[model samples]
Target: MAAARESLLDAAGAALARRPWPAVRMVEVAAAAGVSRQTLYNEFGGKDGLARALVRRAADGYLAGVERALAGNGGDWERLTAVAEWTAAAAQEDALVRALLTGCWSERLPAPPRGPAPVPAQRRPEPPLPSPPDLVRIVRDRAVTALSGPGTAPAATVELARSCELVVRLALSCVTAPPGEGGIAGLIRTAAPRTAL
Candidate 1:
């Protein structure tokens, strides 16, 4: 069942890449995934439900990468640098990720629907999609958790969170204007000194 859901999402995403969401057909998506149309309706109540799931999947995948970046071996700044680089690269490669980070959903993409729909017990509702600032806060908080060593003082934790937010915002800046020569890593080094961060 999980496999079918993933396949359906993969098919939907591929279709979205080629054409706008308004043109995406439920039956075609089902056929592409090798599932029956009835199965598609069963998994996700309808197209809107699928859109919510697809958007949620994108957010989850990006955050998972963030976890990986934060967990990478190195000093705290180095981990933050990994996160910045990951953010830049991901926003460049995947439109859904870019939208999730920047909060700019073009008409071509399915604007995440306004509300949630009830689902089967197996399908838990993803938390509400974050605003752009909320996403930044989420990343910053996660980084702090991953980077803060045990027995760290509250004051130091607050400082670490500030560093995390700075690095994340810098990465987001690079997403729009892009960096000059050294790219995200260089920009991060300039903004985040290893001594303080």
Candidate 2:
């Protein structure tokens, strides 16, 4: 069943790459996945439900990358820079990641403007999984636990955790709006306080 669901998601992703989600019909996704329309409905309930699942899966991938970057050998700041770079680059490449990072529905679909005055509310994409800010907090909390050593002072640990949160937030901000000059590394250095570390 899980394999079937994954196959369907893969099919949906391919279809999304070719065109907008609004144009992706259930029958077509079913055909691409070699599954019946009823099976697709049973697996995902409907199109919106499938959209939520796809976003959730993509968010999970982003979080996994964060964990890997944080766990890598280096000082906290170095790990954060790695995370920032990864997120910035990934946002540019992955539509789902960009949607979650930017909180923009348009990134999840193909372009050229659809319909009349405004797009429908139901068609707009929602980050049904963890938002970028939430992901930052999760990374911050994990960093606190990992960075707290046997002899580390409690005050220092608190400061380190706050630093982690700030760096992660800065990275996310870069992902959302992308600075004209400074880039992720430079942005991280400038945003991090002199006292924070």
TM-score of each: 0.94, 0.79
In every candidate, how many clashes are there?
A: 0, 0
How displaced is residue 158 in candidate 2, in Å? 2.2
Q: What is candidate 2's lDDT per residue for 93-194, written digit by digit as tens?
A: 888888777667684463322223221333444333665566667778876676566888888887888887877777777776786686778877877863
Pairs that collide in candidate 1 are none
Superposed model 2: Cα runs more than 4 Å off: 107-128, 179-182, 193-196
Give the TM-score (vs. native) of candidate 1: 0.94
Residue 149 error, candidate 2, Å = 2.5
Score residue 81 of candidate 2 by CA lDDT. 77
After TM-score superposition, what is the CA distance of residue 155 in candidate 2 from its true location, in Å? Answer: 1.7
Over 4 Å off, model 1: 118-123
